[model samples]
Every structure is written in C-alpha cells, then in structure tokens.
Target: MTRAGTAPAVLLVVVGLACQEIGASFAVLLFPQVGPLGMVMLRLVFSAVILLAIARPSVRGRSRSDWTGVLLFGLVLVVMNGLFYLALERLPLGVTVTIEVLGPLTLSIIASRRASAWLWAGLALGGVAALGGGGWERLDPLGVLFALGAAASWAGYILASARVGRAFAKLDGLALAMAAGALLSLPFGIADAGSALLRLDLIAIGAAVAVLSSTIPYAFELIALRRLPAAAFAILMSLAPATAAIAGFVLLGQHLSWLEVVGIALVIAASIGAVRSSSRAARETAEPLA
Candidate 1:
C-alpha cells in the first residue's frame, strides 16, 4: 500500500495498542478488589460473551482437529492471561510487557533460517539480564517467573491462533476459544474472589476492560492487518513496550529507572531487528524467483 493509504492503518494500530495498555492499567487498579485471577476471569468471560454474541459461531461441521486446535488455543489464552495478571500484581506494567515480548521475539528467531538472528537473541538476553541486575531483592522473583510463564504461553497462543484461524471461519474460532478460556478460568476466579465476582460495579468495569483490551483492539488490528504489509505491522507492534511504559506512567503513576528504560529500549530494538530480518529474508526469496 502507498504511504497515504497505510497512514490510517498505522493510526489504528497505534490507537489499539495504546488502548490495550490503558485497559491493563485500569485492571491493575482493580487488583485489590478482584485479584489477578478474578480480573482474568472477568476479562475472558466478558470477551467471550461479546465475541460469541457478534460472531454466533456454530460447531456443527467442525472436525475433531478443528476442535482440538480451538481447545488448545483457549488453554493458551487462559494461561497467558492468568500469568500476565499475576505478574502485573508484582511487576511494573512496562517491565512485564517488555519481558513478555520475548515470547514472540524468540518465536521469530526460532522460525528464521538466518544466523544473524542469534544477535537479536543475545541482545534480548542482555536486556533481561539488565532488568534483573538487582535480582529478587529489587524485583519479585515469583512475579518474574510468572511473567516468563506468560511469555511462554504467549508463544503458544501465537502458534495456536494460526492453527485455529485456519480451522475456522472469520471470528468463529476466536469466539469459541474465548468461551473455552472463560470456562477454564471460571473455577480459579471463583475460588479467588468468590461472590465478589458478581458485583455489578466490578462486572461493569470488567466489561469495559474486555472491550478495550480485547474486542476493540482485535477489531482494529484485523482491519489494520488487511491494509498494512505484514512487515509494517510487525514493526509497528515493536513499539508496544514503549507504549506500555508511557501508559504505565500516565495512568498508573509507575515510574521506571534509567536502567529499566535502557533495558526496554534494547528489547524493543531486538524485536524490531528480528522482524526486519525475517521480512528481508522473505522478500529476497521472492526477488530471486522474480
């Protein structure tokens, strides 16, 4: 697409990611009342309801493999959200997001056939080490572990999303997977928050969180993906950590040290480098045939 045509999509992606981070900040405010598990359950339940209502997916003709993919995707969603919120309980939003981004970066590196991909991997490791310089004394060790677990689950989510997208039409797979995620998280949510989960005020906030974090962002991203080149979209997404940091500061008053800022920049650079390398490789392969 031309630069003029791509501009709107770029705006959409930026707005979507900003909204997602802002929504996360809001969820953090509710942590004392609902806890991370409750927040995850609430977000998943509301997101599932909204998607199912809009997509109205039918399961009549799906194969066993299709169902399997959806189930696996749902499980990944459950684990990813649960661990992410758990990490948020103890870690700054910017730091957690920076760490979690390693999941996709690692996946990209693993899928690439280029030797230079290792440089990006090393850069990302250096960033993580910088962030962990003071160890558990400065940052919660358990929270860091939870963030890493979320990162792993995010990688699984990416793989599963691709499979489920192939197996089902439109948003049907997403809706079904969201429903399954809500179900899987229901028990843990109830155990954590009990009857408090049913409070109307909390439910309202949760609904808002779901819209901002999932429904609206997903809609915007889907539209942007159709209009933008894959490489462009990937590069745009590499700005997420910076956005998260800004959102953390503006919405939550969470401040990062200079070291943390440098760490985040390194990770963001590594992510962008890995994506650009992959994109260049793809283009070169096509150029040879042309």
Candidate 2:
C-alpha cells in the first residue's frame, strides 16, 4: 500500500484501539450496578445481536468445520471477556491490561524465532517486572491471575479468528462466533444477574458498549488490517497500556504511578523494536536483485 493509503489505515487502527479502551474503561461504571460478570454478559449479548443483525449468518448450509471453529471461538471469547471484566473488578485498568498483554506477546514470540522476537520477549519481561515492582501486592496477584487468564483466552481467540477468517469470507465467521459467544455467556448471565438484565438502563449501556467495543472497533480494524502490514499493526498495538491509562483516567478516574509509566514505556519500546526488526526481515525477503 502507498504511504498515503497506509496513513488513514493507521489512524483507523488507532481509533479502533481507542474505542476499545474507552468501552473498557466505561465498563467500570457498571461495576457497582451489574458487577463484572453481569456487564460481560450484557456486552456479549448486545454485541452478538448487533453483529447478527448485520451479518445475518446462516448456519444451515455451513460445514461442520465452520460449526467447530465457531464453537471454539465462542468458548475462548466467553472466557476472555469474563476474566477481563472480573480482573477489572479488583485491579486498576492499566495494571490489568499490562498483565493481560503477556499472553499475546508470548504468542507473538512463539510464532517467530528471530532476534527481534527474543528482544520483544526480553523487553516485555522487563516491562512486566517493572510494573510489578517490589511484589505482587502492587497489582494484586489474584487479580493479575485473572488478567492472565483473559490474556491466554485472548491468544486462543487470535488463532481461532485467523482460522475462521480463512475458512469463511467477509467476516461472517466473526459474526457467527460472536453469536456463539453470546449464547455461551447466557448461563452465566442468568446465574449472575438474571432478571437484572431486563433493566432498561443496563440494556442501554450494554448497547452502547456493543457499539464502542465491537461494531466500531471491528469495522475500523478490518479496514486497517487490509492496508497495513501485520508487523505495523502489532507495533501499534504495543501502545495498549498507554491508551488504557488515558482511558482509565478520563472515564474511570483511575490514576497510575510513575513506576507504571516506566513499565508502559518499556513495553512500548519492546513493541516498537520488535516491529522494526520484523519489518526489516520482511523487506529483506522482498529485496530486488542487485
């Protein structure tokens, strides 16, 4: 893609990420009312409804493999959202997200064995240690564990999503997967909040969350991915913590410490370095004859 073309795509990706951060931080407002599980359930329900309405996926003619992939994605999606929301209940937004990045970063490292991969691994590690600081108490070990669980589930989502994309065209797979995820979340929603889900305000908030977290982000990311290199996208994603921090401050008023800032910087540096290395490798592979 041309620089001019990639520029808008990059901006779209950034905006998509920003919307995700905003939706996540806004979820805090629901903590006292619906609690984490309740909020997750609502978000899933709303997201599924919206996507289904848009995609109108039909399972009747789909292959068994399609069903299986959708199921797998739904399972991971359930665990990811549930655990992420749960972690937020106990941990600060920035801290929880920083820890959650571990899963994807680890996946990224495992996908490659180059020097850049190792450097990213080391930088992410240093960032983790720096964030954790003196001990686990700074971030709460249990909360961190939940965040890690979310992260691990997120890794599964990434891989499954890739497969789904290959299996089906035009993101129908995602819409179907989201529907499955919503169904899987139904039991939990019933168990955790039951009739509370019927409340009008919560429903409104859930709809808003669906727009911010799923619809807008998905649309922007889809367009962006087509225009930008995967390496560039990955590098841009390293700024997740910083966006989380800003979102938390603006939406939730949760502040971060100086040490936390340092940790974010380390991770960002690692992400940038890794992207540079990967881009260089890609360029070498594409080099013309001398």
Candidate 3:
C-alpha cells in the first residue's frame, strides 16, 4: 500500500488506542462497585450486543473451520479482557500496559528477520524496565502475572483476528466471536456484580465503556489489520503504553517521574523506527518490479 493508504490505518490505530485508554480509566472508576470480573462481563456483553446488532452475522453456511476460528478468537478475547481488568485492579494502568506490550513486541521481533528489529525490541524493553524499576516493589506480583497472561492472550487475539477476518465477511466473524465471549463471561459477570449489574447508572456506564473500549477500537483494529501487516500493526500498537501513561495521569491522577517520561519517549521512538523500517522494506520490494 502507498503511504497515502497507510496513513488512515495509522490514524485509526492512534484513535483506537486513545479511546481504549480513556475507557480503561473510566472502568477503573467503576471497579470498586462492580469489581473486575463484573466490569469485564459488562464490556463483553454490551460490546457483543452492539457488534451483533450492527453486523447481524449469519450462522448458516459457515464451515466447521470457520466456527473454530471464531470460537478461538472469542476465547482469546475473553481471556485478554478478563486478565487485563484483573491486572488493572492491582496495578497502575501505565505499568500494566507497558508489561502487556511485550506480547506484541515479541510477535513483531519473531516475525522479522532483520537485526534492526531486535534493536527496536530492545529499546522498547529498556523503556518498560525503566518505567517499572522504581515502583516494582509496590506492585503486586500476581498483578504482573495477570498482565503477562493478558499479553499472551492479546498475541493470540491478534493472530486469530487475522484468520477470522479472512474467514468471515465484513465484521461477521467479529460479531460472532464477541457474542461467544459474552456468553463465556456471563456467569462470572453475574456472580461478581450480582444485582449491582442491574443498576441503571451502572448499566449506562457499562454501555459507554463497551462503545469506547471494545466496539470502536475493535472495529478500527479489524479494518486496519486487513490493510496493515501484523508486524506493522504490532509496532503501531506500541503507542498503547504511552497513551496509557497519559490517561493514568489525566484521569487517575497518577504522576510520572522523569525516568518514566524517558521510557515513554523511547517507546515512541522505537515505534517510529519500526514504521519507517516497514515502509522502506515495502518500497524496496516494489522497486525491483518497477
């Protein structure tokens, strides 16, 4: 794709990451009342409803492989969201996001043959290490483990989404997968939130969280993934930790020290380097044909 074509995908990713962080901050505010499991349940249930209503996916005519892909995608979504919220319950948003980014960074590094890709990965890892170095003692080990689990699930989600996107037409696969996720999380949601889940105000907030965090970002990512290579997509998503830090400062009153600021800058630099590298590689590939 031309630079012009790639620009929109980049913009979508930026917007999606911003929305996701903001929604996450909002979810934190509700966590005390509903708990993490309840919050995940609300996000999945409402997001599933919105996507299913919009896509109206057909159940008929899907092959067993197609269903399998969708099921796997849904399972990944469930695990990713659950673990992320659980981590959020114990860790600062920025720190959690920084650790969770390792999953995609690992994916990108393994996918690339170039040594320069390893440099970018090293820079990103150094930044994350700096960000967490000072406050590691205060952070719960269990929370860190949860974030790592979310990271693994996120990597799975990325790979599964690409396959499911190809298998089913225009959001149908996403819709089905989201529905399956909702069903899978429903029991936990009920058990945790209880009657609080039925409150009108909580329901309204849950709906907004679903739209901001799940509906919008997922749609943007699914569309962007169709156009962007997985490695490129992962690099673009490197912005998440920086955005999460900003959201934490703005919404959660979490202050960052100079080291953390430098960490964010390093991650941003690595993302830019990755994008430029990918673009240059694309240009070189086309040059021979031209």
Best by lDDT: 1
lDDT of 2 by residue, 150-247 (tens): 98987888899988888877868888888888888887877777777778988798778878988998899888888888888888887888888888
Q: Write the per-residue lDDT of candidate 1 for residues 1-290, one digit (tens) a residue.
A: 46777999999999999989998999999898888999999999999999999999999988999999998999999999999999999999999999999999998877666898999999998888777644646888899999999999989999999999998899999999999999999999888877777789988998899999999999999999988999889888988889999999999999888778888999999999999888878887789799
Candidate with top TM-score is: 1
- Stretches of candidate 2 off by over 4 Å are 279-290
lDDT accuracy of residue 235 in candidate 2: 82
TM-score of each: 0.96, 0.92, 0.87
Candidate 3: deviation at residue 188, Å?
1.4
Q: How does candidate 2 score on lDDT?
A: 0.82
Off by over 4 Å in 1: 133-136, 287-290
Error of 3 at 57 (Å): 0.7
Candidate 1's TM-score reads: 0.96
Please list the C-alpha lDDT of all candidates, in the order they appear: 0.91, 0.82, 0.84
Give the CA lDDT, 0 to 100, for residue 45 in model 1. 97
